[model samples]
Target: MSKYRVLVVDDEEDLCEIIRFALEVEGYSVDVVYSAEEALKMNITDYNLLLLDVMMGEISGFRMAHMIRNDPKTAHTPIVFISAKDTENDRLTAFSLGADDYITKPFSIREMLARVKAIIGRFDSKMKIGLQILSYDKLTINLEKKQVLLEEKEIRFTKKEFEILKLFLENRNRLFTREELLKRIWSDEAFVLSRTIDVNITRIRRKIGRYERNIVTKLGLGYCFEG
Candidate 1:
């Protein structure tokens, strides 16, 4: 099985390192950041799970979690809250924000590891039988394989193009503004212009062949897949 990539976002440097080391020892790929701001700047959609600290400078983990759940690309990623605050209200807030689990501070390493394994395992099982293959008329895409097929013929797409097309296909008939595309597809580290989205969409349409017209442009509303 492939190792799951996990991101730990905490303001405490020592705690982050400890968690990172522990998770890495458990056969998982792990990355640690010291703040929610830093976490948001990176491409977090690639992570299978996120371990977030509830309290931090500027942006609290709860606020970050809200943002993550709102973004289409990262909305489904599993989130776990680790905090010293053990109030019932705190736990409720975490779950309300779509947290998979909440771990109190000074938790046993073994227990934390077990919760991580269980949550990721459950999500993996669900995805194996869920929307892995999406079909819209003659166009089909395998989310797991990142492959696109048109009329049974395979088509090549750049990473960004594939992501954009996947978004369009997943939400057929829903118009997506260029700003929304940039927010969902590109990381904050990159300065992507609206023209960049247009170019990628053009390439996606060209590669799809006969399905080109399925991706329609509204005069002032942005883009959507008519299929």
Candidate 2:
């Protein structure tokens, strides 16, 4: 089996070296960057997981995570925040930014290794299950590529928008209340408001062009992709 690649981003050189050594011992291909800016410059999507520190120079880890989430290419990559800020709000913010897991500073190396293995294992299993392309009329969703094509023309969609469209197309004719959508798409990690789902749905419809009407909003219910 090919070794998994991991990127560790922290301002502290010692911490980066320590994490790199530990992960390498566990048979992972590890790379370390001392700042979020350097991490951003690299092809981030190449790694299987990101180990990010919250309080970094210039661009904070939170800001970096936000940028990663906004970029379709790296949006789905799993992130784990390793920071000293161990507050409830801090954890919430990390999760809201779509982090797979969060570990406060002064954590055990063994525990961190365990968490890394678990998260990567789960992602591998999902990949094995195959998120194949789903097609409906002129619309095509290539889950692996994270691309959406309407009438054979590629349409750019934000991370959330792509996911929302995928869910609707995969479960065509199924009604999804905003609450259900929030839970299903964002999971419990991110604190996404109901209004966010509405916004994404609107954007998905607009991108699909003439097929927009197929996504009907039921009164007192929710949205469903009739096509």
Candidate 3:
């Protein structure tokens, strides 16, 4: 099995070293940075999870997490806050800023290791079956994984893009009117506008790359997914 990559950002060198050493022992790839500024410089999404210290020079972990979630590149990456501040309010603040988990300082290595494993495990499981992967021509849709591959390169699809792809692949070569697509994709939701389907289809077609021309628009009729 491939190891999970974890980014550990803490201003305390000794503490960061200790955690890094411990996680490495458990077969996790660990990257340690002393400040949020340095962590931001690195690619945030490449790591499976971020172990962030709420306190740091130049930028706090909370602020950095905000920046990360705002960027499409790392919006979905899981984050955990590690801080000495153990107050309820502090923990709430961390979670409000998009933290997946919170661990206080003075925590046992054993417990910390377990929490890390648990959080990453949940994310790993989710990616395995969350998206529906569809294969047509050279295009591959990893629907459960929320990923698409074109010519062997991983293509990132936003939530709506993946959903629209899944619907078309499930019924390939079939013509779908805008109303039908809205009903199929947003089944339970009442009153989804036709424009929503158009926007999603536009995004999906762009990701289709060379296959973009394959998906034909039937004028006023609607859209069809062709090989």
Prediction 1 global C-alpha lDDT? 0.91
Question: Tens digits of per-residue lDDT for model 2 on 35-57?
Answer: 99999999998999999999989
**Residue 171 in candidate 1, Cα distance off native in Å:** 13
Instruction: Tell me the tens digit of each residue's lDDT in model 3 across 1-227.
Output: 23689999999999999999999999999999999999988988789999999889989998999999899888878898889999999998888877889999889999989999999999888776544457887788775566788987898888677778777787889999888777777888867778888888788778778888878899999998886
Model 1, residue 151: C-alpha shift (Å): 27
Encode model 1's per-residue lDDT on 1-227: one tens digit a residue.
Answer: 34699999999999888898889889999989999999999999889999999999899999999999999999889999999999999999999999999999989989999999999999998888576888888888888888899998889988888888888888999999878888999966479778888899888988998889999999777999996
- Segments of candidate 3 deviating more than 4 angstroms: 133-167, 170-223
Please give each candidate's TM-score. 0.60, 0.60, 0.62
lDDT of 3 at 136: 83
What's model 1's lDDT at 88? 100
lDDT of each: 0.91, 0.91, 0.86
